[model samples]
Target chain A: MFRPCGLFDETYAKNIAIVRTRQHWILIIIGLFIFLTFPLYLSGRILHFINLLGITLIAVQGLNILTGFTGQISLGQSAFVCVGAYTSALLTVHLNFSFFLALPCAAIITAVIGTIFGAPAMRIKGFYLAMATLAAQFLIPWMVTNVRTDLTGGSQAMHVPAPSIGGFVFNDQQSIFYIIIPITCLSIFLIRNLTRSRVGLAFLAIRDNDLAAETMGINLTKYKLLAFFICSFYAGVAGSLWAHWMRAISPDQFNLMESVWYLGMIIVGGMGSVIGVVYGVLFIKVFDISIILIGPRLTSFLPPQLAQDTAAGLAPFTFGMIILVFLIFEPRGLAHRWEIIKGYFRLWPFKY
Target chain B: MLLFVQFLINGILVGGIYALIALSIVLIYKSTRVFNFAIGEMMAIGAFILYTFLATVKFSLWIALPMTVISTLIIGFFIERLALRPLIGQPILIAIMATIALSLIFKGIVFFAWGSPIICYPERILPGEATMVGKLFLSNELICTFLITISVFISMSLFFRFIKTGLFMRATAEGHDLAQASGINVERIFAVSWAIAAMIAAFGGIMLGIRFGIGIGTLPLVAIKAFPAVLFGGLESVLGAVIGGLIVGILESFVGGYIDPKFSEITPYIILLLILLFRPEGLFGLKRIERI
Candidate 1:
């Protein structure tokens, strides 16, 4: 928050408000207007990327809550996303449920599963918990492949019908944008409120020091499970969105590597901040998309096979390098960088 | 009963390889508190180096093995100096992330060099036919893999027991501060452990490539399989790692043989979760009581 010279807060509402000043509110409105209208001038490909960004933002938000706030690390988040995707896909395909109804149901189912897996967290922490979550990463996909192949489509890609309401199909990028944007906004809004509420405080407490937090009357098991439930819920919702957007689902889509990507995203962004999550997602996803688009073009001089291999390798190589650079140099992530930039502008030409 | 025995023998052979990989991970974790997520990638690198020497250079197996081990040691030393050394005093989680990043970097390099295809070693290098043991037939490569892994593990055990550097490593694992105060070069020990672990991984990688054919994905999967063993044996115990590897191997074999084969893939992870739930420190790990 920036305050001009001699500026003062006269009321509790003004002092505690997230949107502190009239200018802040105006900027927020402008930001929302631009975000909502982005599909109007952007290309279909860009819009597709934006839709992907929206979904990832939701999933990474869950990670921010668990890892960022609650101090619990999950390497199996992709598994929960898979659960959500498969659940939503299975529901829409088998029961003929609408996408609107199936999305939340999938998230709820994923939350339940997450909670069951999270039960072990009270007993194990750190690397051990990571292994536990890693089990989720391996086990969920195995189950999806092996059990009731009829429902899961059995290693075969299951087609997801476009979410339709009253014969209006959301098959195009713009239509999917409409369905995705509102949910993403609402999720961000809800999570923003969540981080400010008592529950959010509890999560922060647990993260800072769980033993101390427990001594201070925080129910470690209950809150830990809650964090898992919420985090996986977000992952599930994102998975459903991704499935419906792509119109196909497979077990390979939610592998351990994807889970690592999400981890890298949070680390590169600010771990505990919502704005940080957005920055991290945008930076990493744009880089990833560019690698997919530009890698082949850049490596075309090599033999066809070699070029293809190099192009495929470029994404991971770049991601690995970026993560190492950021962790070693800017451990606080892009959000911290943003704060520094803002601070510079706020006090331009004035050494404070 | 004979059939069961045959599967048991097959599993032990494979388990030896798992044990070697697990030993590398355990060594790194013991000395430096950093879980080397990239151990599998190191295995792949080691295997590829050997593959180059044997397949492209047409060197004899005897000549290729030492070359691979030396190359792996240099690579491991560079990795520690460049990637891991900076992360020494940082948070444990950050160090872990460094390994994860290193894994991706190594994997990307390997993928670029080798592509995705499985590279076969020349048949003349290792015997192609299986040898009969009583009523059971064991493949020649499996026998070598078993013997090589056992020999490596036994040597490592001896190295830790009697060698001065090994004793320093054990002291470092016990307490870095105390080790440093006692005139042990902890940083050097950390680097040495990484180098030794890398060589072991390379050896295991070569053995696995000989048995299964060298592939980009083979060692990473094996590395992940090593996790259950690490957890089962306690992350710090060398003997525990070996025993854990054998147990996981036998369990996997039995599960594949008696139950569904698909279940075999996940049986180790299931056992890992069970052990974690009941004993988070692991079966052979020393439990530290935390005082708030």
Candidate 2:
């Protein structure tokens, strides 16, 4: 609907399509082709890194819906992931369900649990809601580790079987990438459409002003809980995918730090937009992975004791600095920057 | 019964330390309307500073104690001036995220300085002997810490009630714009509140370090534990934080002693969730009303 320059939409379907122009379609195809063929030329480590990005993007996408779209901050995202991971793992290992069958089931169960936790959002907002949701961060892990040691494997990690689709086993890194890529693309496409739908408008309304939304006859309780459910469902799918890919699950994998990282991703990428999720996850994850990779090499030149300290502190210190800088100077995030660049190109040959 | 009493006593003693930290959090939230997530790091840094001064620099307790408090107060003031001051009029979410970043930075700094090893405070700073009183044994350090905590509380309560500066802080807490209109110099009050909070956190940190030794990861855990207390007592009420801290401490102790040790870890959070469900504003907190 929003046409710039000489761009025009001739049909209703064309106007609503995500890839608006022919140029957009061509770029998307080229991007997908590059990603699809990367395994041929890239190392297993790089593939593994993309695999992590894919999984985290899925979860961050969920967080974008809750915190970004709906304006409800949840520090309990890791807990929701834990539920999904454990549920999928349990269904496969204990009940002998297939990975495909278990993944959606796990997501649904996590959604139910997420909805329960999100019930407080109707009455509380802002920091109070953040604190209340933190209960999930503390409680879910405790429950997994303590309540039923048998099903969850307690403090010990549970093993997952390699998922197979009609005799093709997704066991190797490349094979897992095949599974991850499709799911990741599907999630992005679906969420992109979701944010453009009526439900998304309601979520945006709630985020902007809950009281105003309520007065406008938007059922705060229903929509807020729905956002929680949908968001947690995304986390569930990510957790399920991760579990099957890693072939092992543990409470430690989905901890408070990971939840915070997911939040940082949305904050850094830009909130309220679908593509922002991608940019945020890619930026933070790449930064983080680079730190892990380069930290040791950078520290090797220092004295052994000091090196150890520096190596330990470098990642968090830099990550914190990035978050601080973004919040202070560029609170709009990477997605906003992307738009600015696009605008510059669109307005090229003419000074603003 | 005696065991229960022992746990109760231990809980109370530990609760005193939590009360100190919760009070600091409550102070900042009251005055600045910002829930500082960096508090645990503040405490950890304070403890580390005390360790550096006393163990590394060879300062005596009498000198090191005041030095640690003063330096930590300055650190707190800088955090407000640098990190939080720029965040005025921002959404609560952005401010909270900033504090989280500040916490990470503080944690990184401490890790860079001291690494991950647990650092023990010098034993000479506090009495180490255990004393018996009617079949119960109490650590002399715990007793000393408890006494200091009581004195701090009494002095703080008096300060808020009577002192001119404290009155300015209270006024500022009531409404920043109103206080500014009344010529209260709200920015100075904000800095002072943060300083006072930081000093209290430093005190708690020193005591806890003396009790359990200071570790990078465990120091921040204190802030997480203090959350339920701050919420339970009410974020805006100092007295509420004190009571909430004690309740949480004793609840954790009883649960750990009776039900399961693991339950103690989540007891505070569970209480927080329950409190939020039943009373979103908290016991002593003012009801927040949304305007259309």
Candidate 3:
């Protein structure tokens, strides 16, 4: 909220505007332009990465609202995403529903499932709640794999048809980028606005102290479950995008480790901040891609027996090390650092 | 009736190891208030270290077992000092995430050292013969495991009841500031708890290795299976952890035998969800009263 010394808002509209300064508007416009036109200039590999990044960003943003904002730690987020993916995949494959129709249906179903799992949150809290959600992580996948093996393809990969809009097929990464990036932008916009609303304030209240929030007459049950609903909705959207993007789906795609990685992303980014979600997802995704790129080269320097293990192990090792470093040294995360840097710029040439 | 008894006995034996692993988790949680998510990896690494000594270096069991315990204790101590100590006053989420990170780091280390192979101990740690109780056959390895687990329970109980260090740990668990005020080194207690927890995890891992052969894939899953037991017994209750482990193990055995083999995998988590809904405090855990 810090601004340059000479910029004062004379009107309420100008004061409340998210894009307050001319520089902010210009930066937003230019950033959107570059992001929208990326496929035109960037290589296929980078575009593919961006598409995946965009989808992951949506999922992490939802996580920020739940864990970061509402103070409920869900260890089963990827499981919720799995529900969305499988639901969307099944709707298209069996029921012959349009991609457009299936996406929302998938998201809604996932939200319902998430809410059901979150019902236990009403009774338990902290580590116990985490364990309850952890049950969802295991049980959902088990159901997907074993309960209806015939329908779900039973631990085997179920092929998802490429999404099409009246003969314009989104068969490749570049085409899917069109679907992923815009939705990512819209999701960012909605979540940002949502966090600034009355509901968002209620979420913040509960997160800070649920018991206190209840004393303040903030309806705890409604908001907590609502947060879970919205969180899973975002995951459902992301999962649907993922299934369509990959052209195949499996229970393995959304495992417990992926759930942990999502939590790690939000933590690294800074919980309770939307821009932080962007920073966190981008940081981790880039780190992951770079590791994959560098892994073979780094492994070649080691002895052959050690090489294979190093190649496989380095990514997780470094990832864990980074999370540990962040938790220890920068627990407030990169967003807090960004705030400090912004403050420095705003108060330029002044010690205060 | 005979078949049911056989499954029940088998369940109790396997449950003994589950209880041991759950105890490791409960120990760290009680002392430091940090849920050690890396418990599975701790168990895996301990088993691997034992495997290296017994199989790779061909050290005698006498030397290898003690060495494994010492190395794991050091690992646990350094983990607390380097990773967790800095985040002491931070939020609970940060502490939990730290353990998750530790789990990943430990997992990566296990992968780096052992790769993916299922390695067996060079010699059998227990007798292989199954003793027949009428028509029900009980394996010697399992009976020994149950006896060892019971002895461990006894020793741990006695240690907590009688020993000075154990008393300090109890005091620290009750309240950090209060313990420090009473001349107890709270920091040392945290390190000691972690060390002991790691050693216990190693014991569970070694016991499991004796039964199934140590594999990176399966050992961690076993720890996860123990989670329900931890929850069922109550997070803070050693008795609860033991009883919970036995119940979950028996439940899994029955489910596997009667219902389906696959259902057994998720039975613990199902119980976890059920416990959270009906009795979040667990059967033996103390019910905390929150005040504003």
Candidate 4:
């Protein structure tokens, strides 16, 4: 909402626009140009990282809507992502459905499943609700592994066919970047608009005080379920993308730890803000990637007995330490810092 | 019928261990209101510490046991002071995530030190023989575990009932501001509660290690299993933890015995979902009334 000096909006449309000034549009266009053109210059490995980042961004955005906006904590998001991956994989492999068709189907089915698990949110709340969702985290994977071994390939990894559009295959990371980046942008746009709407206000209200929101006739059941539906839908999309991108799916890929990492991303990025999701995901992912890159080299410096264990342990140790440091010092997350930086520039020559 | 009795006895004894772990969780939650998801990691680290002293360092049982307890207690105290103390007034979710973060750190430490092998105590801490009680065989280790668990519960109850520190902890659990107004050092109580919880978790971990080798992989799962017990007893009720643990243990044993071995792994979570659906307050937890 901070505008630079000499910038004034005369029209309501101009005032409410997300990209308010010409400067804003220019920056966004430049950012989008860099994002879309990354594959041309960047290595295939980096492209793969971007694809994962974009997919995770979408998932974290959904989580932002649920936990960050609606104040419902979900520890089972990875399970929902698992469901989405499995659903899409099964649809394509078994029914011979197109990737496009399977993607939507995956998202919808995941939404339905998420709603079922979230139904307990109506009855329980806080830690109890977290426990209820935790059940889903365990139960869904168990079902996937044990229920239909023949169909799901049981605990063994299932091969996922690369997504294709009318004989145009997205077989590699570079090609998948085109599919992933655009969808990521679209989701960001949609969620940005969503948070500015009436429903977003209702979610904010409920999050602040559910009892008061109920008194204000916000219909806690409808909005809470809606948040879950949307959140899982995003997870489903991410999972479908992940399945195609990896060309293989396994239950281990989507575990409780993955869900916790997603939560960590949102917390670190700044909860309730769409941009925060991007910051959170990018920060955590980049940190993790750096750890992976640096771990081997760092381990060699240590004594041989401690080297292997330290190599395996450094990522988690640093990651956990960062999360704690952020929670203690910058609890509002990187988004708050971003806001402050932007505000400082906007209010140049005047202290506000 | 005789086989059923044997399973039942096994369930009760195993349940005692679960109860001890649940009590640790309840103790911290009661005082600090932070749900310690790191509890499993705490247990693992405790067991690993004991393993290090007994196996690697070659310390006698008498020295190693008390040393492990003291180390864990100190670890708990530092965790509260360093990691958790700053998060006191934060949201419940933030607090929970802090514990999760702590869990990750502890996990990394365990992995760094022990390297993921299933290690056992160097020597058998409890007798291996099983006592035959009219065709129902009871393992002496389990009986000892059950007795220790019961004594802990009894002492904990008495501590909360009569001791001055216990009284202060209870008062702090009720309300921090009220306790502070009455001249109770709420911060000290928080530290004490965490220290005691860590110690109890270490005890539970040792018992579990005695039964099953101390593995980084399966200890967290045991903590997850204890969650249903915590919920079943009500989050705050000490007695409820015991009853809930027993019920979960019995249910798991029966399900594992009757249906399939794998079903037992998920039974506690299933019960947790069911409990949340029907009785969110738990059987013994005080019903909370939300006010505007």
* Per-residue accuracy of model 1 over A1-352 as CA lDDT, tens digit each: 3455777889989876777788989999999899888878889988998998999899999988998888888989999999999999999999999999999899999999988888899888777888899888999999999999978888999999999999899999988999898999899888888998999999999887888999999999999999999999999999999999999999999999999999899889977888888999999999998899899999999999999989888888889999998888888899889888887887798876
Worst 10-residue stretch by lDDT in candidate 1 chain B?
B120-129
Worst-scoring 10-residue span by lDDT in model 4 chain A: A1-10
After superposing candidate 1 on the true structure, give the runs of residues whose Cα lies further than 4 Å from its correct spot.
Answer: A1-8
Q: Extract clashing residue pairs from model 2.
A: none
Q: Which consecutive 10 residues in model 1 chain A have the weakest lDDT in total?
A: A1-10
Model 4, native contacts kept: 0.72
TM-score of chain B of each: 0.96, 0.96, 0.97, 0.97
Q: TM-score for every candidate vs. truth?
A: 0.97, 0.97, 0.98, 0.98
Give the per-residue lDDT of model 3 (tens digit) for B45-146: 998999999889989888998999999999999988999899897777888899999988987888788876788888876755779878888888778767
lDDT of 2 by residue, B133-235 (tens): 8987777767776677677778878988999988988898889999999999999988998998898888888888877899878878877888988999988
Please give, as one word, the docking class of candidate 3: medium
Candidates ranked, most accurate by DockQ first: 2, 4, 3, 1
Strongest candidate by lDDT = 4
| Runs off by more than 4 Å, candidate 4 | A1-7, A303-305, A345-352
Where does candidate 3 clash, by residue pair? B233-B240
Give the per-residue lDDT of model 2 (tens digit) for A6-55: 77778999878887778989998999999899888899989988998999
What DockQ do the predictions score, one after another?
0.67, 0.80, 0.78, 0.79
